[model samples]
Target: MLLMFLSRFRVLISGLSIALFIVLYGFFSMRYVPLSIPWLRLVDFSFWILSLGSCLAGFLDLYLFWRKSPLISTLLITIIGLSITFFARLLSVFYSLLMTSFSIQILGGSLIDKESFVITTGAVAGSFLILGSTSIHTIYKEPIIFLKSSTLYDLMNTLRNTPIVYGSVRELSNDYYIIH
Candidate 1:
């Protein structure tokens, strides 16, 4: 159910909510205007939306992995999902802190010169950094191989040692090896 929403609606909502939160917080954090409501109130909704999206993504990932691995998929998804949530919260803190710090400058009779390009580029880079780093780490670790047992390793070895693949790969004569 959650995955369905995430795959379809949750992604858009979370992304928009995060963007809205960033804009609103960035606005208030830099200016420190008197609020009729509260300071950074929009952030609460954004955080929840982001958390739900992360869990949905994680659950769907586990479901896909369930075919090959019942245990490892469950564990990795749970752990990584939690970690993503934690990191998102940290980024939110960074956003809030940066805004608040800038607010003092604005209040001190300094003009807030907004650079549209810089914000867009920063957002793109930050998104890439967050997503790219996690993906690269996952690829380097090759966690899927770890989920395999000794039996699977032996089977893979058997396949790799087959004459067709061996001749193509090693370019060795049949007499160089023995088949018992």
Candidate 2:
């Protein structure tokens, strides 16, 4: 079990690290280097990479669900969702900043407006907050039951072997008594 846990932990860490590296590299490359590739293509490729990473993390979460506590599983899912949402939003901000900087370098004035950035960031934050609250509420409201057949049988046996306690009794008459 320990070996299995360590292997899964390594996989999770490596996956997140690779995803972070890709996002950083992509952002820096887009911002600093001038490539002949179209901006739309770059955006599409970045989205695809981000989607793939999210999918991989989701699969890993599902694969290890049974081994983890329900609370931990719920937290992992929530964190993964929030991280992906944050990264995607960050990438959008980085793209916008790069565009604004590039335009300013060429035009001597900022062509990009701040309203769009503000709106986008606000919307992302609002949605993330709503999602997080709902997820946590749902997770706490639901109970986790991981009982196996053998475990159920053992529980029944143990319950059967336990002694039963009787409450105090009240005497009604010589031959009649009531147990409370």
The TM-score leader among the candidates is 1
Model 1 clash pairs are none
- Once superposed on the true structure, which residue ranges of model 2 sit more than 4 Å away at CA? 1-37, 66-68, 71-180
lDDT of each: 0.40, 0.41
Tens digits of per-residue lDDT for model 1, 96-179: 446657443211112212221122223333332323323432444322343533332333454477555433454333323333
RMSD of 2: 17.2
The digit string of per-residue lDDT tens for model 2 on 50-94 reads 444444433333344423434333434444554555555555555
User: Could you tell me how far off, in angstroms, the CA of residue 166 lies in candidate 1 after the best superposition?
Assistant: 51
- In candidate 1, where is summed lDDT lowest over 10 consecutive residues? 108-117
Q: TM-score of each candidate?
A: 0.35, 0.31
Worst lDDT 10-window in candidate 2: 104-113
Instruction: State each candidate's clash count.
Output: 0, 0
